[model samples]
Target: MNQTIDTILNHRSIRKFKPEPLKQEHLALILDAARSSSTSSYLMAYTMIGVTDPEKKSALASISNQSYIKDNGHFVLFCGDYHRHMLKADEKEKETLAYNVQSTEYFMIATVDATIAAQNMTLAAESLGIGACYIGSIKRDLDLVNDLFQLPEHVVPLFGLALGYPDEQQEIKPKLPKEAVYFENTYKDDEAHMAALDQFDQTIETYYRTRSTNQREDSWTKQMIKTLHNRRNDRLTPFVKEKKFNNR
Candidate 1:
């Protein structure tokens, strides 16, 4: 494989990081890679907030309940933002675009745009020998995040990316079989999918039992069951609506 593919294949989430901050040049390169990502119709409805203040990082770590948020060399919150687009329209004397901006379509567009940019940033950081971890817990309390960042309407924090030099190296976790995910022209039958998962469950169980860190006796389906059962984020829809998105 080429160097790019090798980099992509070796991707791992690095939780423990060194105390030193990222170099300014590396940070610039990562942010530039994020900006270079493709956007929907070139709207580029996303904003990245690089958190450097010790107090602010502490607050975010408290909010996320993950000390790595504060301990990392750098933390960046990626936001789905349409506020700038609205400002642009207003500047051009086009006030009628509010309805489209409030539509669920636009909200999805912004979310996708932010996600794409974040992946680009992650790859760039990894290629430069930096470690990174994604913090989805930023959505745990949107209201507090909004107040902490003083986010205006039509802008919502989606997730965060914590980057730093690696303090610990982790094994690359296994993924589902290609047959379970990739289909030629149509999705595989449910029975075949379950069979594939059933076989893969053995591999996952072995992985969990044999991994050096946090070894546990569990299968992917069991973990998925617990995850799905505990997936209760009632604040998400209300918070999104409060940000004036998806009303239509």
Candidate 2:
């Protein structure tokens, strides 16, 4: 495989990082790569905040319950932002139908933009031999995160990314087989799909058993089922509404 594809396939979440900081040049390049990602209709609805203050990082770590959030060489919060667009439209005396924070479509576009940008940054970091982990647990306390970042209306912290030099090694996790996820012309949930899922469960179980860290003898299906049974993120809708993203 080519270098790009090889890097993509070898991706792993690095939880433990060395105390060293990233060079300014590398950080700039990574941010540039993130901004190069595709933006929905060029709205570029994503905004990235690099957190460096010790007290702020400590608070964020508490909110995420992940010490790495504070210890990483760099912690970046990615936000789905539409406030900039709205302000620009107002200045131009232009009507913005899509800038309505309550519109689900607009919200989705902003989310897509943020997610794409984050992935681009992830790939760029990995290519530069930097280790990175996506701290999605920040979503557990969306209100606190919003308050900490002073997010205005039409802005939401989607996730935080922790990046630094690796202090530990980890095995690359397995993913479901292509047949189980990819569809051809139409969607199908027949015996073939079931068979692929069953096979993938075994594959996942083996990976968990043999992984270098946090080894557990559980299949992907079982883990997902248990997680789903907990009914997570019940507060997410309310938080969004509180942010005045009232459009459905």
Candidate 3:
């Protein structure tokens, strides 16, 4: 197998980091690589807030409920930002910033732009021999995080990244079967959806259960049911609507 293919296959999320900090040169290269990623219609509608301060990292950790955020060498909040264009328009011509936001299409474009950039940053960091973990819970309290960072309107936090040299290794978890996901022509669903998923859940449960001495893990279906029934995620849809995307 090719070296690049091997790297891709071996990819895993790394949360524990070495005590050493990243060098300035490596940091600059990662940022440049991320900014070089393709943007929609050249709008470049995204921005990143790099946090090296311990206080700020602690704040993020408290918000994310993930202790690793404070321990990592660096934390970065990637935002889907359209405020730059709005401000520019306001400067050049007197137009309300919401003039084009009535449609949700533009909001989606900015989100895509931000996500692509964040992925580029992750790949670039790993290429530089640094381990990176994505912190998706950064959006849990948009109001709190926004106020913490003093972010302006028209910009939303997509996710965050914690980067540094890895101090520990974690096994790369298995992905679902190709047939369970990949579709050709029109989308095809396995007729026995529950059965197919049950098989996978058993596979995962057995593997982890054998490896650990802790309490037995719940089945995949149980976990999914608990997640959907939980109140934690119910706030997200309402919050997004409040942000003005208005999916309805």
Candidate 4:
């Protein structure tokens, strides 16, 4: 297989990082790779905030309750942003032209654009032998995070990316089988879906038991059930609306 494919297949979420900071040239290259990601209709409705200050990182780590956020060489918050577009419209005396920026369609577009860019940045960092972790727990207190960044209207924080040198090697997590995810013209029936889940449960159970760190007797199904049952963060919709997104 090609080196690119190898890199993609061996991906792991790294939470522990070395004390050294990322090289300036590598950081620049990674950011450039993020900018190269495709945007919907060339709108590019997203922004990345690279946090370098130790105080800010400490605040973010508290928000996320993940120490990696503070220890990582670099942290970047990818935001779905339409405020820039609005400013441009106002600048050109064409405020009415960008009236749909708050619509749900535009919100989805910006979110997807930000996600794509973050994935590109992750892949670039991985290719450079740098470790990276996606920090979604920042959403636990979305308002605090927004305030921390001092975001303007029409700019919503989506997630954070922590990049640094690896201090620990983690086992690659197993994913669902190809057959379980990829289907033909029509989606598989309920029986087939259950069969796939059953198979994956066994595989994941084995993985958890065999992994070197945090070994446990659990399956993907159990984890999913627990996660869904305890899902809390009900503020997402309200937060998005407050940011002037998805108003339509």
Q: Where does candidate 1 stray beyond 4 Å?
A: 91-95
> Model 1, range 1-248, lDDT digits (tens) per residue?
88789889999999999999999999999999999999999999999999999998898898889999999889999999988876756544545666668898999999999999999999999999999999999898899889988999889999999999999989999999987887788877888788889988999999999999899999999999999999899999989998988888
Q: How well is each residue in 128-153 modelled by candidate 4, as lDDT tens digits?
A: 99999999998988898888899998
Arrange candidates by TM-score, descending. 1, 4, 2, 3
Evaluated at residue 62, the lDDT of candidate 2 is 93
TM for candidate 1 is 0.96
Poorest lDDT segment (10 consecutive residues) of candidate 3:
90-99
Model 2: per-residue Cα lDDT over 1-248, one tens digit each: 89899889999999889998888988999999999999889989889999998898999899878899989889899998877777756544434544355688777888899999999999999999999999889888898888888999778888989999999887878888888999899998888899999999999988888876688889989999999899689888888876656467
* lDDT scores of the candidates, listed in order: 0.91, 0.87, 0.78, 0.91
What is the alpha-carbon lDDT of model 2 when measured against the actual structure?
A: 0.87
lDDT of 1 at 125: 97
Q: Highest TM-score, which number?
A: 1
Residue 163 of model 4: what lDDT? 98
Flag the better candidate by TM-score, 1 or 4: 1
Better of 3 and 4 by lDDT: 4
Question: Which pairs of residues collide in candidate 3?
Answer: none
RMSD of 1: 1.4
Off by over 4 Å in 3: 90-97, 192-196, 212-215, 231-248
